[model samples]
Structures are given as C-alpha cells and as structure tokens.
Target: MGKWSNQINGRGNWSFTKYIYDNLYNFQWINRENNEIEDNLILTKSISLERVEQYIYFKDIFKGEYFSKLLEIPEALEELKIHMPEGYKTKEDIIDVINSRALNPNLKALDMSLPTHLNFVLISLNLPPHEGEVNDPMEYIVDALEKKYTKEENN
Candidate 1:
C-alpha cells in the first residue's frame, strides 16, 4: 500500500483526527514532490454556518440520547446552560453562537468524508479559548502544517 493509505489505516476511526492527518500528509507530500514553498493548501469545499450548527446540535442530541442511561437529560441541559453562551437559550441560538465564534471565515463547504473543509471545522471546534485574545485555531493548524512540511526551508 502507499504511504497515504498506510497513514489512513493507522489512524483508524476518529474522523476529525483522520481528516487533519490526511490533509497535512497530502500537502506535505505535494510540497516535497514539487519543491514548492506553500503555507497551506486551499480548501476546495465550503461549509455553511447553518450546516455546522446543525452538526453540533445533532452530535449533542445524539450523545444525549445514546448515553441517556448514564447521563440524564436534565444534567445535560444543565451542562449546556453553563457552557453555552449568554442569550443562547434555544438550540438554534446556541448553534448561531458556535458558528459565529468557531467557524472560520475562509471556510466554504462541508466535506466530512474528506479533509478539505472538515479540517477547518474540526480546528475551530477543538481550539481552546485564549485568556484575553481571540484564538483562530485554523490558522494555528495551518502554521503547524507549514512548519512540519517545510522544515528544510527553515534550516
């Protein structure tokens, strides 16, 4: 098997991690083969904020239902109350808040099956809040990928 297939197989079933890995790996290979100095590969697909919100809401709802035996609906609601942003009472409001804060402006569409757009979505979701500064996790990931792929350029 080729290197990409081997990496994908090794990553197993974590969708987000696998997505990031695939993009970074492929970009690195391209840069190496072409001897090009590129910071990031342009994302072809774009995801709407509405879609992102829907995914988050669905994921949360599914988890609530799937783990109902261990996690009560009331408890889940309480957690949502604490973590969810102010003025975000309904599911739609919460999704709006998440989209406004988490979704990268450069993102175009959702391609969950591939790394193109999903990597940016995952980056936004996975980024931790900074103490005083706004954190754009997608940029951080791009920087990391660039560094990883262009180490020779640095030296």
Candidate 2:
C-alpha cells in the first residue's frame, strides 16, 4: 500500500527486509514496556548497539554470563549480505532496504527481540552517512520504528 509495499511487490521473497520490519516493531514494543515499568523495579534495560558490542566483547574476554543467545553480530552481518538485493554496493541501497522495511505495514508486529536484531544489523554493518551522502539508514530505522510504535499505540 506504501512505497515499501510497492518495492516488496517488485521483488518477491525479501526475507531480510521482512525480518528488519518485524524486528523494528518488536523493539518499539519493548521500549514502550520498559517505559511503563517502575524505574527501580527494572532489572535490565534496552541498550544501544555499542553497549551490546561491549557486552559481547566483555563476555568473550571474561567468559561470564551470556546475556542473549539471539543472532550474534557476525551472523547478523553475514545474513545482511546474504539477503541484500543483488548488485547493491552503495550505502543508499542499504538505506532503501531499511526505509522500505520500515514503511511496510504487513510485516509490522511486536516481537520484543527486535532491538537484538537491530543491534546485530547496526553493529555488523556501517550505517553512518559520509559527507555528501543523502540517506542515513540508521536514522530511517529509528524513525520507522517510532512511527510504527506510534501507530500501534494509537490503535
């Protein structure tokens, strides 16, 4: 129904795109739930990709407790490369994928583990925009997640 849906229609079976879309909604739900909880009662809070990486590094170094066994950074990156559209080499291609997925309503849902997925993709890939670069996939992802969450909240 939207630009993302059109793009998805143009290409059949965009599993990775669907994965990102679903995860973004899931992450948003988790954030909402975290916000609803009492501050002192919260045990673990949502974190950024950088923090995830740091935790992974520290866990590997100290062999301490494993926080989450979901998709790891390396695996997430490999999956991104595998699912990326053919001949997509530029950063815009990546941004398009993120935007398209964000706009895709069919795949939106509350999976709750989305931040893990997002962190995996973000830490594994280079999403920052360079000089003269017009699109930033990172920002698109955040906006998409927020928009989807807002829509869900209203409903």
Candidate 3:
C-alpha cells in the first residue's frame, strides 16, 4: 500500500484502496468488454493522494450546469471540482455528471452501462463517512483540506 492508504484504511465497509489494488489494469488503455477506454484511463496503481487532490482541486473545470447545484454549498463550490475521466469526454462528445452532482469519482469504472451509485470520490481527499457525518462526499472535503493543512504545518 502507498502512503495515502495509511489514513483511509476504513472507508465505510469498502476500502477504496483495495478496490484500486484489485482493479488495477496493466495496460493504460484497453477495451474492457462493455466499455471502450479511448483516452488513457487513470492508471489505478499510479493513484496517490496528491494526484487525486490535483484531479479534484484543479484538473477538470466544472461546467455551469453542475456548478449551479454546487451553489448550494458555496464553500465547496469554491474549492472542489470533479475529476473527468480521460476519454470520457471530448470537445465533440462529452458525457459528464451534468445532470446531477452525484459525486462519484470513478465515473464509469464500475460500468457505464450500469446505473450510477454516487460514491463521491471520498478516498482521494482523505475524508470519511465518519460514523454519523453527513455522508455526502462534498461535505467531507473541508475535513480533508484541513487535515492536509494540519499535516503540512507539522511537517
């Protein structure tokens, strides 16, 4: 396991780290039966806290449609942005969670043909379901940022 896994060993009955470990594909791009990963899909093994943070905080610009819902959480709207899986979108044809902010990070990894479960990219940010905390992925982002800053200060 990598360094990030240390902080998130218990993730609501589903270890996201284990999921990545189990599902990591050797090839960068492969047509996995039901889906065709045209662009370089995220090499699951290469995933780290820094990379996941980068993808969430800076990589993909939020569309106005999605940002509209984000308006409900002004602070989160300012900080978090969704990670657009490579090849999932193109200038010509893009299919994003524009309909609703489901907060699922692994866009179609589970299977696009299947339904979306709104997993909300929690592991990367070092956030948690935290027993009784509001289970929304966006809700824990503040906690993740605070934790990162706290660690940085100590370091």
Candidate 4:
C-alpha cells in the first residue's frame, strides 16, 4: 500500500486525500473521438503553488449544471461515473453515512474544504505520470467536462 493521509471532514469521516505533491504539468485540448489525431503539444512546466491555485480557480470557473447537486453523496457518485472514464467506480459504501452526516453543522462548516466519497474514485484510479510528463490523468477529466458544460450552459 502507498502512504496515505487521512483528514477528518466536517462529519468526522476520514477523507483520504492521496497525492504525490511533485513537479507535474498537465493540459487538456479538444479532439474528435475515434479519429486518428496527432498531438505534439506539451503543457509541462514547473508551476508554483500559486499557479496551482490559479489552475484550480480556472478549473472551477467551468462548472457543470449538475455540479452543485453532487454534494449529495448519491448524486456525486453518479456524477463521478458520468464524468470519469470507465473502469473507475466510486465506493458507495460510505454514501449513507455521509448523507446522514451532511446534516451536521460541523460538517457544513468544513464542507468547502472537504472531500466527499466521490473523491475516492479519483484517488482509487491512481493515474500517474505518462510520456515523460508527470501530470495526473484525472485532471483531464475536469477539462473534458468543462467544455461540455460550457457549451451546455451557453446554449
């Protein structure tokens, strides 16, 4: 097993946030599916924590219509399945307990910084650096959904 860090969220259930905080670069672009395409672009460069924050902000700006509903455990799991690529599944085992605890004031207070069970789905994938690049594949997921979301919201 890899090293893990467990932090209690508002309801006190442990949020297992696993990541190798390292020099990583990632970028996502548009493409046609099932068509032969060549990508020679690289989005790699050493970025500061501030840049990560900027990326996260830029990331959050393109929110999906169903995003807010995902705070509810079941909705979140379903959203994960839809948003994420196949072979990865969120652990439903904690849904009931998490939903129940969502009513707690403490959890509510800490909700903004908390990771729900759906987060585990990404953690479970354990995607790593590829092609001499160390970017997390999961990050591409956000980019993919954001484009769809933007088109949807604009229409």
Candidate 5:
C-alpha cells in the first residue's frame, strides 16, 4: 500500500473538511521515486489579511453549501481586524475573537448535516433589522451555478 493510501485510510479521526484543510497546508512535491508527497512540516507563517485577499479571489471555486457564508466571514474578519483593539495579529486570533461574541445555546433539534449548517448561517445573515427579508443562500448558489454552467449549453 502506498503512503498516501495509508494516510487516507487512517483518516477516521478527521472530518472531511478538516482533512482537506490540513492537507492544503502542505507543500506537495514529487519524491525521488515519482511519488507525490508533502513535506511533513507545519508552517508557522500566519495567514494575514494580505493572504486573505488572495484567498478570497479563488474562494468562489470552493463552493459547497457553506461557500457564501465562508466568503462573508473573511470580509467580516477583515473589518474586525481593523476595529480590533491591540493584541490580535493573526487571522486565527481574529476568528477566536469573533467567536467570543456573546450568544445563547439556543440550538434546536434537527438534521446537523453540513448542508443544513450552511443553510442556517445563510438564513441568519440575510435576516433583517426591519428591512430586507431573508433569502436562502443555497438557492442563490444553485441559481448562480445554473446560470454559469447552463449558459454554455444553451449557446
């Protein structure tokens, strides 16, 4: 069995998104035997706002149900970065700070799937302070994809 396959099979502890996030941290390269391998080292380099800008440009390509909410997070984070009082420096730190906002454990019983979580966040964000009514982010994403992919089919 190959090293990658071994790791792949051994990934029972990691969630699928977590696994992808972890692998993305590595600098992958071909080894002497033409095997694809990653340098088994974690980078200490912090993901800065500058890096986040570059990340946002390609973020749309990573569309899952959570894509729009994930995209909005970076924007929310960037704003928080500027407004943050002294101490926070890295994006991870800012994420922690954002997460610190007071909230109640008002979670209700329902399907706890990834797609469901994505829809929850989308609905919450689109909720209004006496203005626009909430729209389903998932539907927006589907419509956008249909327009992009189906346009060529019609042509």
Candidate 6:
C-alpha cells in the first residue's frame, strides 16, 4: 500500500493511506524463518496500471466498486493540482475552483465490507459535493506513505 504510492517524489512519505489499505485487506507477508519481513515484500505484482486494475480483486470483483473510484482520484488531482498551483482545499473546491458544474455524478462502492473513517473518506471524495460537510478526502488515496515505516512516520 504505502510501498506503491502514486507520488514518486513523495513515493515514501508518512500519510494516511495505510489506514485505508489495512481496512480493505487483511494481509501480512509469508515468512518462513525468523518471521521478520520488510516493506519491499509489499507489492502490486505488475508494472502496468491497467494490468494492475485487472488484478484488483479479492475473489470475483474489484475490492470495492468504489476502489476503482479511488484509483481514478489521482488523475483528477493532477488536473486540480494544475488549476490551483497552490493546492486543492476540499473535494468541492476541486469542482468549484475549476468552475465545473456545482453538481457532479457520484461514484460509490456498494458491496465492499471494509468500514473505517479512512475508507469512508476514500469513497466520499468521489461523491457529488455536500458542501460545508466533509472537506479534503484525498489524504488517504494520494501518496501519503513512506518507503519504510517509522515511529515518526506513523499515519
């Protein structure tokens, strides 16, 4: 999760993505000896995003219907990042600052089971704006992780 964040420069920074990753999947490395492992052991199994998308399932479907939505967020952020050279303030700001229609088609993950504040935010970020409610929700999906975990790097 943190190991494969989208931001290359921030490829490994301490952020909130881990909470979402842990909630979605109960995963740990297979260690045969001392049982200690490293973060490099965490990986996506492919180099291509499309190929990765094909494998983003637990059994029969993408982990969350909205997981795909979370996946699309980075591209949207890239657009927003350019428009607001400083930074994007909230999910609605991404729309308002861009002068997009105040309303937007929302995407939600209906069947996935993970429940956590981080999980909620990942989905909320894609939904049509409920302004004056939740604010920036991209901290979870964006590259907010570190190559290596540290007490100081806790998310």
> Per-candidate TM vs. native?
0.21, 0.20, 0.23, 0.22, 0.20, 0.16
- Model 6 over residues 1-155: C-alpha lDDT tens digits? 43322322422322223335433322233233433221222223342222111112122222234333543687755654564636564555454433333222211232233223445545454523223332233322342222223434776
Model 1 TM-score on a 0 to 1 scale:
0.21
lDDT of 4 by residue, 77-108 (tens): 67656654355455443333333443355444
List the pairs of residues colliding in candidate 2: none
**TM-score of decoy 2:** 0.20
After best superposition, candidate 5 residue 73: deviation in angstroms?
A: 13
For candidate 4, what is the lDDT?
Answer: 0.38
lDDT of 4 at 25: 35
Q: Which ten residues in a row have the lowest lDDT in candidate 5?
A: 49-58
lDDT of 3 by residue, 1-155 (tens): 32121212332121122334565532222234423232332335556322222122211324555555655575653343334445443322223444335644444343342222223444444545344434433324556668878988999
lDDT of 2 by residue, 67-106 (tens): 1222245664455557677975344454455545443443
User: What's each prediction's clash count?
Assistant: 5, 0, 1, 1, 0, 2
lDDT of 6: 0.35
Residue 99 alpha-carbon offset, candidate 5, angstroms: 16
Better of 2 and 4 by lDDT: 4
Q: In candidate 5, which residue pairs get closer than 3 Å at backbone N, Cα or C atoms, i.e. clash?
A: none
Candidate 5, superposed: residue stretches over 4 Å from native: 1-77, 80-86, 89-112, 127-155
Model 4 vs. true fold: TM: 0.22
